[model samples]
Target: MHRIAVLLVEPVVGFDATIAPTLFGAAADADGTPLYEVVTCGLSRAAVTTTNGFALLPAAGPEALATADTVVVPGTRYAPARSDGVLQPELAAALAAIRPGTRIVSICTGAFVLAAAGLLDGRPATTHWRFADDLRALHPEVRLDENVLFVDDGDVLTSAGLAAGIDLCLHIIRSDHGAAVANEVARYCVVPPWREGGQAQFIERHMPADPHASTAATRQWALDHLDEPLSIEQLAGHANMSERTFCRRFREETGQSPGGWVRSRRVERARELLETHDLPVDEVARRAGLGSGGNLRHHLRRGLGMSPSSYRKVFQGS
Candidate 1:
């Protein structure tokens, strides 16, 4: 079994401490057996107080670091001197105790701790968007991308604020378990399973100011007819324009091509039903408009590099 050690520093916030165990601990094969074990550790084996006024009894100390396949540092209230991007000395030493090549993850301001240890130098990472500017200024050597929900840089990973930590942890689960197991874990945790590293962090759709020119109707119509054979020609006719003009209009409205938008939504729907229902894969294919499990497998592989059964295994609501 894979072992993950979550390092809790002083004044551990409630949110970060809970993400890893829930995500990693839920990983299992079809037999309903555990695939990974997560241990919560601290600088020492002490009662670590949380920001919510609760105290936690850590199961291990920094010695856990040497045995950790992955080490995670979560947000703390002890950021000082360096402001939003500072790390305390004891926390720094605990980080230093981690074995080399151990995958390191940071939740919210925990990126500050990794940054201080120089682990993030010249690496792309993100923290909470609210403190993104400060993180950038403090560690410009570490490329700070503020728009992604999380950044997966091989050995190191970093996430946005509190809830995005959920996304990041789910991502790590997906990486470790393949899409099947990760999807199940997401269902168990009530989170999305496989948001890619490149997805927009939080791009809100702009409601049409001029409803007359809006693409909402076209999008809705496409969703309603995902099973039917629909193409740019059909959508353009619905919009009453040449295919080329309709294509331009669609991209302008959604920041992605019509095909890309349709594909993403299909995958999204497939994911939802996979997590919420136990329908036969072919039925799921029909509902998601992917035709057959074979076809679903084809597209899922092209879009997510996994099969439908595999994706369902990970994302299914447990």
Candidate 2:
């Protein structure tokens, strides 16, 4: 089995530390055999206090890092990296114990640790959106894109916050095994398997608290009619609003234009068909309102960074 070691620095965010083992530990093959052996480790084989006032006794220490195929560093509140852009002495030594070529992952501000160790230099990375400015200020050399949920920089990966870590872990599973395995894990965890990493971390959703003010019904109708050609004017008419009012409200509610939202929904439908059905490309495109195979390929490539055939190949049986 692949061995995964979760390294927890002192004052660790308890929720962040549990995510790796909780997801990866639950992954299994068709025969119900565990795929990864996950262990929690600390600076020593002793108890460490969490930021939430609880103590956890780890099964191993820094020594486990050398044996791990993947090393995960969860967010920690007390790491020197947060303040000084440097690793603590013991933490640095512990990080040094990791074997070469081991996959490195950081959840939330744990990116701070990897950045401090210079592992994320010249690589795309992200942390919590709220901390993006601080991280950029501290480690200007790291290519920080705070808009996305996660960054997959080959051997090094970083996620935005506690929840985005789930997305990153699922992505790692998909990358390592395949979409089928990742989807299975996601199902077991009761979460969505594939949220494109490029999706915005913060959407400008102003809740339509007034029942009469919501464009929700019109949006749902548009989804139902995606196979039919949709137009902004038609959508505005459906919502009983003028074209200008509808466009403004749509952006405020969904953080996307009407046309953009329709396109995205069409792409999503196409993706689902590609992953779960055996239909031909053109048929899938027609069903998804993408018009033709060429159009489907264009949208998938531009929106998802892959072609229809490649996407199907990765997820057909998933």
Candidate 3:
């Protein structure tokens, strides 16, 4: 059995701890042989409280991590560790005890925990999009990528907030085993087998109560015409605003520009088409509105660091 350890901290987020077991635990070979043994541990044996209402009775302490092939850090409650970037003594010590060469994975603000322990320093990683600026300010040495759903920097991996954890977990399964097994796991978990890490993290903020107080309509229209050739001016015309005002409002409402949003949608469409169909690369490019396969390759390479064919072969299966 591959021993996987989940390190639960004080006020841990339930979703984070649940990720490993729900995905990797549920994973099985074609004959239903479980591929991984998951263990949840904390600083001590006491019941660990979660950000949610409940607490959990952990089966072990830091010792559970002693022989783990992988150690996972779930997101914790908002504290100085989250904002000011302080580390509790116990958490730091627990992290220090991790076996050498063991894979370390973080979910959402769990990146804060790894950063607090100095593990993320001088490494490329990411966390919840909302916290990217704060993480960057405190940990200047770390290479922060705000756009990715997760980052696989060899021994360490970090994922964006909430559901992106699923993407990272599925990615790990694919890397450790292969796409075929990972696809089975995804089917078991009701998730896509492969999600490009470069896929934009959906970081929408709550809009005002007044229906009139949103740019949602314009964004909706943009989505409807994602495959259409669009320019900033055309989007501005739809919003009934000048270029400068539209640009400002667009950024505030959507957290991205018209062009950036369109490009992201194109990439997402290409990824889906690549995985679900056997269309020629050129047709995939045409449907995704990337003009041609060469153009699609350029954008995919820029965002995902892989050629379209290479990406499809890796994730779409034989």
Tens digits of per-residue lDDT for model 3, 1-318: 888999888789988879987888977766989889999998899999998889988889888888899998888874868767888777777777788999999999899888888899899999998889988998888899988899999899999988899999998886666556777878877886665676668745446456564667877787677667778888888877788877776666656776776787777678777876888989998888788999999988876688888888876655
TM-score list, all predictions: 0.71, 0.81, 0.69
The lDDT per prediction is 0.78, 0.86, 0.82
lDDT of 1 by residue, 20-110 (tens): 8878887888899898889999888989999887998889998899899998888766556147566667766777778888999999878
**CA-RMSD of model 3:** 5.3
Give me the displacement of residue 233 in model 2, in angstroms.
3.7
Model 1 stretches astray by more than 4 angstroms: 81-86, 205-318
Candidate 3 or 1, higher lDDT: 3
* Distance from true location, Cα of 66 in model 1, Å: 1.2
Q: Output the better candidate (2/3) by TM-score.
A: 2
Decide which is better by lDDT, 1 or 2. 2
Residue lDDT tens for model 2, 1-318: 899999988888888988999999989877999989999999998897888889888899899999999999998876478888998788888888788999999999899889999999899999999988988998999999988888887789999898889999998887666666788999999997766676667767667667667788898899899899888889999999999988988877765678877887788788777877889999999999999999999997875588888988876543
Q: Candidate 2: misplaced stretches above 4 Å?
A: 29-35, 174-184, 192-194, 204-206, 215-226, 234-265, 299-307, 315-318
Return the clash pairs for model 1, or none.
180-310, 180-313, 180-314, 181-314, 182-314, 183-314, 183-315, 184-314, 184-315
Q: After superposition, how far is residue 90 of candidate 3 from its true place, in Å?
A: 7.3
TM-score of 3: 0.69
